[model samples]
Target: MPGETVEASAGSVATRDARTGGGTAWLLGSELLTLFRRRRTWAMLGALALIPILIAVAIIIAGPAPTGRGPAFLSEITNNGLFVGVTAILVAIPLFLPLTIGVVAGDTIAGEASHGTLRYLLIAPAGRIRLLLVKYAGAAAFCVAGTLTVVVVGTLVGWLLFPIGPVTLLSGATVSVGDALVRLLAIAAFVTVSLLGMSAIGLFLSTLTTVPVGAMAATAILAVVSQILDALPQLEWLHPWLFTHYWLGFADLLREPMVWDNFIDNAVLQAGYLVVFGALAIGRFLTKDVLS
Candidate 1:
């Protein structure tokens, strides 16, 4: 039954490809639709959007958090509402952000398999490689969307609840609201890249089994463990190697001149993980016996 559907549909798939000129755009679009159409995707996104709202509301009620009382940018929020997004990003990066990403990426392949649609997808024109790439692309899109959800919502909520004006950089230099917004976008980009490594890992894990939950849990756990290792002073040597090492380094983007060192290093580290884990996922998926 596993290979039967693919075998039977191979000819039809080829015919469809020939008639349609064999474009992959449709497959990718369909994948994205399938991914976002599910209620789970929006639920996770909604949860992420709430981080900044709750933070802003609590700050309004309780007054400015005592100096050094909360996340790095929290104290600044009471002065300039713009920092709300940054602070929310800082709070979520440790666990919440990755948690949502894990749910999406882990469900990439395993969810389809569990639903018995994987075999049909692998029939022809959308071969193993094409499907894998489309799946990864969908997951990556979610990363960007998820990050922006928190950022945009935080910005809006902060503006409405508190006074917004010039943003002071960590270097004590002031920048206009427009410039600060550009920096916020840059920070969001940085956070999106930071999640790619985890997405790739989740993709690989999804290829290993049909249980989406297992892959999702493993991906989130790995993120937490990486951060834990990054925190331990004893593991200083290992810190640079972990994908999460430079997560909070987005703070550098807020400096007067905007430090690019951590940004470059983080991109390179995440890229390495992406390549390694992406290859592993491809290998496993190509050889995997689809019996769902």
Candidate 2:
């Protein structure tokens, strides 16, 4: 009875300790501040802002009236934000999203190692799992921000240059401006989720290599490979499992009634990748001997 009493007391204490572990909010905040302060992050944001501007300028230079399914190209982009957003995702995800997440997450533990601060941080009261979670949360925030930046900037520029009237659907149907805007937002949200899979892959790679460059390079290579696999018609069966495959599901938003089958399947696939890779990252970080 006395031994049982001791075990119960210890269990309660452990539970309390876990609960009191500093919330993820502080870690998330710290990660965000670090990212915002970096000149490269600002530079990336600036470059993304330029995308729509360039599109607008090109349209202007060509002297073609705006054309979507309707009279204006801007209307096409807006009404079919799913298409525009997916286009942006296709372009950005391969190069930009992974690079951005890798820059931050790759630097996460390695930056600390490079600066000779990793050991000190490890020695701090925070558990390795918690610290890793903080790093991941920060990277994930960057992923969300980066994806939204592309969507918002692209949409805004497209609207400014083209007509901001009602949207014409691909099915020869028409919708009001307000309805188009709502659909665009939905599409943006979907793209954001798809981007998170890339972020998780980047973070996992970050944990594997001590050199930030190596981590970045590895992440990029993995992305490239995934894209290649997705493109192979022979590998049709594997397409649904690849994170890059569903990256275009945002296109579904443009379809009337929206195809939930592929979109939902993609979400499930991405979620599986996130969980598996995230666990591996945490496991590696926890077991790693921080000699640096």
Candidate 3:
């Protein structure tokens, strides 16, 4: 009788484990689809696309840059329109770009909680960690999508409006049109990687509040504060630690002899931010009360 009771209890525990332990991939897929379907996602992408178009048109109408005022890329846009696209991305990455990521990432958890869907999601067998991963994946998808919008639109608009061909590197070496395009792709990837830190920070903030607006505004404000601190001469000691300090380092990618030092630092720094904040979000979410 004792042996039979122990066996029966073990079997019930096994059954419960089986029900909750699998299907992680399916849950991730469903969350990705839901993120992609949101109207706000599409609208944010559309707005981002307009930046490159406006840059190309303005450069075309204004004639060649005087070479003394605007960015080095702008000065060369009249020579090869490719510069227009790259230039647009450079402009966006510092502020407008991260703001978009903040909007999406900040809303990841808080939005659902605000609308009372988070409790229902937690009621499933997917558990807290799995749900958080799905949320992070959705935010990461938005980062890639937002960067690609600028890249694709910038390239096409530049091609249609100006000469498209071989490009002269910042180091004075010439690269084939094909090579230049590849470099542009690398630049876009770099920009996307740079935002992962912001995404992580935003998601962490989202876990702190049920109000999506508060999360979104707080995330953007933190980014702004970091940038401002990075600018202060007195805070030079803290530059290396600031998330935005190396954001513009993608410029090194365009050099004839591609420099990897700053680029690598940027990636490593972002990865660090992601790990720290992602852990914080998970730890807090695990203990957080979810009555909504």
Candidate 4:
């Protein structure tokens, strides 16, 4: 009987440890579920999904967009439904998408701290390193999910309203419809990867202050400021380092032979930002006092 009781205790410890292990897989699941339950999360996703609808409606009404100075994809969308999805993603990624990411990333930790919950969360066996990783993962997940929302919704809207066929690339070459679909998916993925740097920046800012609002605003400002700097003629030397610099490299995915140079550079640039800002967040998070 004593042996049986000891076995039960050991099993219980194992189960608890599974949840509290270095992997912290259980905590990650719970946090993600919690994140999805927030109304703001749904609101952000809904806003993203709405972008394509608005674009589709506007173009459907405006006719062929002058075919010259307007949006590059405008002339193609009515003919190829897939471009609707691509254009929506292209439009949203610049501002609305990053702003939404900033709001969520900034709130992840700071929200808890401001609400007097960070201390309690840390009081548990969860390591700061583990918690920080989970928070940032949640933020990145939002980025991917948000980007996907625009793509899926836009594609559906386009398929319903416009003719469905092969997408015409900026180059004169034409590919099969199936190939175009794949390229659109790749473009969506590229857009998501491009935002990793922004996600890292947002997550780092989130760690700076207990005020979630401040963190959110500061993160958005950083993105906007980086983009502004990227546009300066005299600051061409700094373009390579800016988070927004290579964002439009998705345009390459549409080209025949699939241009890899700019695309690879963008990925490497984002990786650098991810490493630097991610390290900054982890370092600061580990040492900072959690008075809230």
Highest-scoring model, lDDT: 1
Q: Could you tell which candidate, 1 or 2, scores higher by TM-score? A: 1
lDDT of 4: 0.81
Clashing pairs in 1: none
The C-alpha RMSD of each candidate to the native structure, in angstroms, is 4.5, 10.0, 9.4, 7.5
Tell me model 1's lDDT, rounded to 2 decimals: 0.86
Whole-model lDDT, candidate 2?
A: 0.66
**What TM-score, to 2 decimals, does candidate 2 have?**
0.82
* Candidate 3 minimal-lDDT segment of 10 residues: 6-15
Error of 3 at 67 (Å): 1.1
Task: Kindly list the per-residue Cα lDDT of model 4 for residues 76-136, writing each as its tens digit.
Answer: 8878878888878878977999889889888877877776667766767777888888888
Candidate 2, which segments miss by more than 4 Å at Cα?
Answer: 1-22, 65-90
Q: How accurate locally is residue 150 in candidate 1, as Cα lDDT from 0 to 100?
A: 93
TM-score of candidate 3 against the unseen true structure: 0.90
Off by over 4 Å in 3: 1-22
Per-model CA lDDT versus the true structure: 0.86, 0.66, 0.82, 0.81
TM-score of each: 0.93, 0.82, 0.90, 0.90
